[model samples]
Target: MFQDLDATLKALLDDAAGPAELQAADVSFDTPDKDYKPAQATVNLFLHEVTENRTLRDEARVMERVGDGYTSRMPPLRVDCTYLTTAWSAQAGALKAAEEHHLLGLALRWLSRFPIVDDRFLRGSLKNPPQLYPLPTVVAQTQEGRSNGEFWSALGIAPRPAFSVTVTLTVEPFDQVEDLPQVESIQITSTSIPDPTLAGRVLDHALTPVPAVVVTVVETGAQTTSARDGTFIVPGLGFGVYTLSVQAPAKPVEQVTVTYAADHQTHTVVLSGP
Candidate 1:
């Protein structure tokens, strides 16, 4: 992947230089140290750093349907590749500085015009397999936590006029993709629920309506109290036979058997004693 990026950068620079005098200058990726030297005018783009672009990081997985199954894979990793761009001229004295400065200026101008590396300039794997994402370019930007003076000093060379270029690229995290079988059919089932209710009244042996009596269904343990009108209601019961237990103040409990039906009707329970 790094090699592909190098080739792509070289191609872009070549296009930028076009058929002008700068076209004859060699584009090198070699480390520029004290011992480094070029025979003619050259543009040195040293790949100085590579780091993941966390802001562009994606954790989602991509899925595609193929034949009878679906293939899924993690999203590609995005990384920023930083390059230290410097110009070199074989000429000496003030002429050398002038030519180097001119070359650097032209390179910077051309690179700045492009926010993304054009697809036509891509080479090698970047072109053959085709890129999934656009290559975003950042020209002449200050690198975080990097010092140009220290970089030159570490290389045992004097500080020179240079700029940095960063390009964002995507890398596939894995080659293997998971395959899932396609679902052929779906089934759904539903059931009808019955909400039957029981309503009744309580009375004493004298055939007078009795209030404040507790009415309970012995089978389901459902209970309700008779209202001031001596009527009580119990909802959410299914169609079946249920035993009603009626009890009033200072009276014996009375048991009445009744059948609950879809067509509801009030039943009367008469206590044996007053």
Candidate 2:
């Protein structure tokens, strides 16, 4: 993958320098040190740093439909590759500095024209498999807190006029994706809730309204007291048969059975005297 990126950049520079007749200049990826010498004009792109682009990091998995099923895989990892670009000239005296600066300027300007590396210049695996996302480019940007002087000193070479170019690439970590079966059908069921009111009146043996009498449903243990008018109501009753127990002051508890239905009528329970 790294080699593909190197080829892509070389193709891009070669195209850019073609019109200027600078294509004859050699494009080198060699380490520029004290003993390094070039026989002709050269443009060197030294890959110095490679780091993950945290800003473009994605943790979500990508899912795609495949026939009757689906396949899911993790998103590709985005990485930034930084290159220290410099130009070398074999010309002597003042001509050397002028020619090098001119070459560097042309490379910088042409690369800056594209925020993304053009597809026409893509080479190797970059063109074969094709990139998942466009290769983004950053030209002539300052390296974070990195001193060019220190970099050249470490390389045992004198500092030269140059620029930085960064390109972003996506890497797929997982090749095998998980396959999932598609849903065929769905089922839903619902039931109606019972919300009926069981109402009735309490009476004495004399057939007179009897207040202050307790009425209870034996099946559900639901109870209610007779109102001043001898009326009582038990809510939330469903269709079924239930035993009613009635209790009056100083009287024996009386028991009666009643059936609750959709059209249940009011029931009258007669209590015995003490």
User: What's the number of clashes in each of the models?
Assistant: 0, 0
Question: 186 in model 2: Cα distance from truth in Å?
Answer: 5.6
lDDT comparing candidate 2 with the true structure: 0.84
The residue pairs that clash in candidate 2, if any, are none
What range of 10 consecutive residues in model 1 has the weakest lDDT sum?
Answer: 186-195
Q: Write model 2 residue lDDT over 94-171, tens digit each, in one string.
A: 999998999888788878987998999888888888888899999889858868888898999879998999999988
Clashing residue pairs for model 1: none
On lDDT, the leading prediction is 1
Task: State every prediction's TM-score relative to the real structure.
Answer: 0.66, 0.66
RMSD of 1: 18.4
